[model samples]
Target: MALLEVRDLVVSYGKIRAVKGISFDVEEGQIVCLIGTNGAGKTTTLRTLSGLIRPAKGSISFDGTALTSVPAHKIVSLGMAHSPEGRRIFPRMTVEENLRLGAYSRRDKETDDDLRKVFDLFPVLAERRSQPAGTFSGGEQQMLAMGRAMMSRPRLLLLDEPSMGLSPLMMKKIMSTVADLRAGGTTILLVEQNAQAALKLADVGYVLEVGKIVLSGTGPELLTSDEVRKAYLGED
Candidate 1:
């Protein structure tokens, strides 16, 4: 069975639908990416799966447990961590404090070990552990945000637009970190506007347009497809 299964999911903001009956699954130890342009409801879909936005219809099951009715905090405790769009780190908190918050749900001594692991993953964070999160540069803040998410020791990590507001160099660093995380057995559901970067790193890819999936394929298949090349890769 898939580690994370989303079946016929629908989400709405009042009368307007944001996700119109979409379904996807992420297997254990796979990186599944959803690529779409702005306003295509990619972030909305991630939010719904993360339990930040309640679904209007359909079911979300993670590791065979029903998640559609769970509270956002409960979902995280259940081993799904969401690193939201815009990198919403607590501005006044120290880098260490911000990361500690991610482990609030856990009582195990291993949480500290996970914190050390995150620092190892992003050494800049270790260097600035005592500093306020707000003081970091954009790229550094994004790294801290990801490191904070890692503190949860999640089985499924949901990432929304990790490369937003980053320099080209910063974007490369962040995406490479994602690849490294996947290699370490993290199952990820990624939403990205950078189609080229995302597809290159994903095990499988799905394209969303107007709140529905338009295509789904393996990474190279989507990368080489004529429609994807024209619409997302900017190739003629």
Candidate 2:
């Protein structure tokens, strides 16, 4: 069975529906990317999976547990972590402080080991461990956001627009970290508008438009597909 399964998921903002019955799965040890334009429900889908937003109609199963009814805080304890869009870090807080909050759901308050692991993943974060998050560059802040989420020691890591607002060099660093995480056994569900980069790194790819999946395929397959090439890759 897939590590994370989302079936017929629908989400709404009052009268307007943001997600209309989309479904996908993330297998263990693979990177599955959902690539789309802005406002295509990619962020909304990740938010719902994180329990920050409830699905109006659908089911989310993570590691064999039904997550639709689970609260946001509780969802973190179930081995799923969301590094949301916008790199929502606690600016005033120290980098360590921000990362520690991610482990709040864990029964064990001892997070030293996890902290070390996250630092290893992002050495710059380790260098600025005591600095206020607000003082860092956008790329640095993004690293902290992903590291903070990692403090939860999740089985399934949900990444939303991780390459957003980053330089080519910075974006490459972040993407490389993603591959490292996968190599270390973290199943990832990624949402990105940078289709070329995301699709190149992904094991599987899904194309979303207006809250619905328009296509699905392996990374190489979708990269070569005419539809994805035109719509997302900016190729004629």
Candidate 3:
């Protein structure tokens, strides 16, 4: 079975149908990227999967268990973590404190080990563990956000716009870490506006337009496709 399954999903903001019957899946230990332009329901898809927004219709199943009706907190405990857009770290809290909060639902003996793993992934976070998250540069805050999500020891991770609001160098740094995360055994469902970076890292890429999947293929396939190259890859 797929590690994550979103089937015929529909979501709405009042009368505005945001996700109009979308479907997708992520396999274990694979990086799956959802790429689209703004207002294309990319964020909406992640939010619904993370339980921030309830779906109007369809099923969301993780590890073969239905999660559509589960609360966000409950979903976290079920081994899924969401790193939302805008790098929503606790501004006033110490970096360590924010990371600790991510493990609130975890009671396993390996909690400390997981924390160490996150530290290793972003050594800068360890260096600034005592500092307020708000004090870090945008790139640093983004690292902290991913580190915080790692605290949960999730089986599947949902990343929304992980490279947003960062310099080109910072975007490369963060994207490299995402590749490392997959090597370390975390399944990822990534929603990103940065189509190039996302497709490069993804095992499979799905293109979303107007709340529906318009195309999907392996990373290099989409990268080399004439249509995808013209529309998203910015080929002349």
Residue-pair clashes per prediction, in order, are 0, 0, 0
Alpha-carbon deviation at 172 in model 1, angstroms: 1.5
Give me candidate 3's TM-score against the actual structure: 0.97
Candidate 1 lDDT over 36-149, as tens digits, reads: 988889989988888888999999999999999889888898999989898999999999999999999887878778989999988999998999999999888889889888
lDDT of 3: 0.90
Per-residue lDDT over 1-236 for candidate 3, one digit per residue giving the tens place of the 0 to 100 score: 89998899999999999999988889999999999888999989988888889999999999999988999999999999999898999999999999989899887777678778888888998888899999998889888889888899888988999899999988999999899888989999888888889999999999999999999999888888888888887898
lDDT (0 to 1) per candidate: 0.91, 0.93, 0.90
Instruction: Give candidate 3 misplaced runs (Cα > 4 Å).
Output: none
Top candidate by lDDT: 2
| lDDT over C-alpha atoms for residue 26 of model 1 | 93
Worst 10 residues of 2 by lDDT: 101-110
- Higher-ranked by lDDT: 1 or 2: 2
Clashing residue pairs, candidate 3? none
Q: What TM-score would every model get versus the actual structure?
A: 0.98, 0.98, 0.97
All models, RMSD in angstroms: 0.9, 0.9, 1.0
User: Candidate 1 — which residues are off by over 4 angstroms?
Assistant: none
Candidate 1 vs candidate 3: the lDDT winner is 1
